[model samples]
Target: MNEHLKVLCSLTPCFYIKREDQASIIGGVIEFIKELQQFVQSLESKKQRKSLSPSPGPSPRAPFQLSTPQTENPKELGARCNSPFADVEAKLSGSNVILTTISRRIPAQIVKIINVLEKLSFEILHLNITSMEDTVLYSFVIKIGLECQLSVEELALEAQQSFCSDAVYVNDI
Candidate 1:
């Protein structure tokens, strides 16, 4: 099996990706990961619709909103990064950026997240990773390139999109 596929399997013990399903994409494994993420989301939304209410052309309800689960209280410097799916943040100080993410320790999840940083043309000056039983914490200090255009909010969105798994909250789908 491909390395990323192996990683995907590790993250998602429920879904099994067949070797034959490893089709071609422009960016190889990273693009494949994005595709799989979207596929997973699509399935979850369909499942949500089915479960929420049956009489649906489209439910008038608003889409779900998510917030970081952290408390407003202060935490010690090295405290654990805790979040069920992912909590992504980016802070830009001049040309340097501090990026942090807490995500489930599933297969290609980390790779996908790091790719988001690299894709933004940043030099990873410092990277610290901590893995607990089921969650992983990532902290990075990166210097942004001259050509980088994304603001801190955009960076957070990219990282969140990259690693956050939507199906995690659901028991089985």
Candidate 2:
């Protein structure tokens, strides 16, 4: 055998890592792996839950794109209105409706949105606002009254008209 091999074979126990330290490190790694596995499982379960959700309402369309109106009423600005929002979407969640509006930070526009909601007989349950760089997101959880007969299309058209009427310049929304 080589001289280095002989020395390694006969080295004192302290020359190598302690078994306890090795076990501790291995245990920590195992624990981290287990935690990572649990996190993945949680994400998968969330996807499963989303897939199993109920069929959508009568007027479900693409989230970002508005559906074409069956009839063209002179009063309604279905898709012609120039909106400032990067995205405007609404969905029914449980007993409330969630309206998500993404736009550049326009403080006055928020008040207009709130007024629109109040005018529609929607009770605002919660509002979540998030700002990122130049854009801001507004999420409103609104409860529709049982007596209300307005459809999703009506709500959208009314909101759009409100903006269109208020806008004096071409750049306004």
Candidate 3:
């Protein structure tokens, strides 16, 4: 019996060394006792667990390395069309639209503005508010539904009327 096996047997009562009658007879009782004693002494060291299965091989393909380019659109020069809302930039992209307005009083006007857009059947996706020295403006990136058919100019005018004044001014933007 291996020394590690002997210790494992003593610690765990489930294991036992079977006595072979012919081998025990040849060794004699005293020799058999000495062999068992040697086995117990060898078991003082710990037994290492062995794995039954072999390790897996490395993968064939290399991992993906994503390289994103760092670039920016060229900044355009020239005085932007000047108006009281000169900072506003509105654009329609597919089903989505972005409306940016620069104003001094937008914070106090957001709720009314959104209500007007809702009335016009525009569905807002996101709204961002920004400010400068007592004036706050908002940018809304909206998803206009498939059923929407109003012109951007008309919508802008409606928004102006909804937030800027009580009087609805048609045919003007």
Say which candidate scores most in lDDT.
1
lDDT string for model 1 (1-173, tens) is 57765565555322123232555322245433543453355446545755886563333222323333232324311122222245565655335776767555768776777777788887787776766565566767788888898766667767776654434322343
**Each prediction's Cα lDDT score?**
0.55, 0.53, 0.47
User: Can you write out model 3's per-residue Cα lDDT over 1-173, one digit (the tens) per residue?
Assistant: 55544444444222112343434333344433442443333222111101322433212132222222121322311111113322333456445665555444644478877887788788888786655454455667777867777666555555555444542334343
Worst 10 residues of 3 by lDDT: 44-53
**Least lDDT summed over 10 consecutive residues: which range in candidate 1?**
75-84
TM-score attained by model 1: 0.48
* TM-score list, all predictions: 0.48, 0.48, 0.44
lDDT of 2 at 47: 46
RMSD of each candidate?
15.6, 21.1, 34.8
Candidate 1 achieves a global lDDT of 0.55
Candidate 1 regions off by >4 Å?
A: 1-84, 165-173
In candidate 1, which residue pairs clash?
7-107, 11-106, 11-107
